[model samples]
Target: MIEGPYFVLVVLGALWCGVAAGVFVAFSTLVMRGLGALPAARGIAAMNSINVAAMTPAFMVVFMGAALLCAVIAVVTFVLWPEPGTVELLVGCVLYLAGSFGVTVVANIPRNDALAKLAGDEDSERSAAYWRRYLSEWTLWNHVRGGAALAASAAFVLSLT
Candidate 1:
């Protein structure tokens, strides 16, 4: 049987992964749509603000903390290979670390950075074009993040069984 603290971390990590997935789902399903409906400048401004504001300590606890815990689980399982639930735990870790979090760092964040650099003037052709690209591209990666996070949660749940 897994140790108590390790198990708790895994479960908490899974819950946090679910929370991250829900955030992405909300963006894909409603938030992005609502932003898209607004005027280009306003939408871009709103999204930029959201991106900046989302860096709060609370969000970091969930996002970065979950990833950190999941990573720890991965490393521990790696060292303790041949354990009963190691495979499932490893799968969950990989999905969260690479697919969900990696995508955010590699794809979504750079887009956010680019948008942040802009003046957010929708009337400006350059800003307008950037907003258009940001909406579609960001939403697409958000879907990926959501799917990966859900998969990670499933794997973590499997590890429990």
Candidate 2:
């Protein structure tokens, strides 16, 4: 018989992955903006970076990695994609992963590193200047990353119909 539970799993996994990705983008935007709001905010952003660094390695290694593993297993479980449902689910999952990696690797980490270094030091012209630079640059990329996540989620939901 065609697999039903596995089929449901794919759809649901895509749904949840999409949701989690949207949340990540939102929170990152909030963090970026919060950091931008004040001269003293660099320390907050650095703390947030430590939060991000703590979170990302584990997420990249475990949760997102597990989702990828699930998608790979789904492909192998049925000789062909069991349904259009599966193809859409897999594509949504890929978009979520790629978009997420783009944010974390491309945008956040470098900003985090810069924030960490500057926040680690005292208030100074260079440190203040560095934070100002991050405020402008980081916020722009966060929006792009957030949009990618929103698109991924919308596609995942459409796949359910």
Candidate 3:
């Protein structure tokens, strides 16, 4: 049961990601809907900043930790998974790490980079343009995040196996 302390990490990482997935789905959806109503970059910028600030710490921890943890889980599973629904849980874990987390780090982070450049001081065309473009593109990624998270959540359920 202890050859792989990694599985413990994997389960920890999975639960961590699972929580993040839930938060991402809800928050990103709000950002998406916010796009239609927020005509200013300031509003969008505020939302983005707050969200990033709130998310960065946990995301950094889990993103760095997941691979090591999951790999251990894979090894442990290969040797000693309980054999009921282990496969489902493992696959679900893979999907979240591969799909949802991938989208957040790859797709969303870059957009946040772009968004961070926009200034919120007074009315400005560049800011508006940035907000408009940012909202549209960001929302697409948000949907992807939400979908992937839902899939991951389903995978988390497999832990019962």
Using lDDT, give the best candidate's number: 1
Candidate 3, run of 10 with poorest lDDT: 1-10
Sorting all predicted structures by lDDT, with the top scorer first, yields 1, 3, 2
Rank by TM-score, highest first: 1, 3, 2
Give lDDT per model, in order: 0.88, 0.59, 0.64
Q: How many backbone clashes does candidate 2 have?
A: 0
Predicted candidate 2 versus true structure: per-residue lDDT over 52-161, tens digit per residue: 67677755553365356445644644455665555655565566556655566778778777677665563777777776776677666656656655565566556567
> How do all models score by TM-score?
0.94, 0.67, 0.69
Worst 10 residues of 2 by lDDT: 61-70
TM-score of model number 2: 0.67
List, residue by residue over 35-125, the lDDT tens digit for candidate 3. Answer: 5586675576676667567567666665545444555556666666766556765786676666666777898888787666654552688
Q: Which candidate is the best by TM-score?
A: 1
| Stretches of model 2 off by over 4 angstroms after superposition | 1-3, 40-79
Per-model C-alpha RMSD: 1.3, 4.0, 4.0
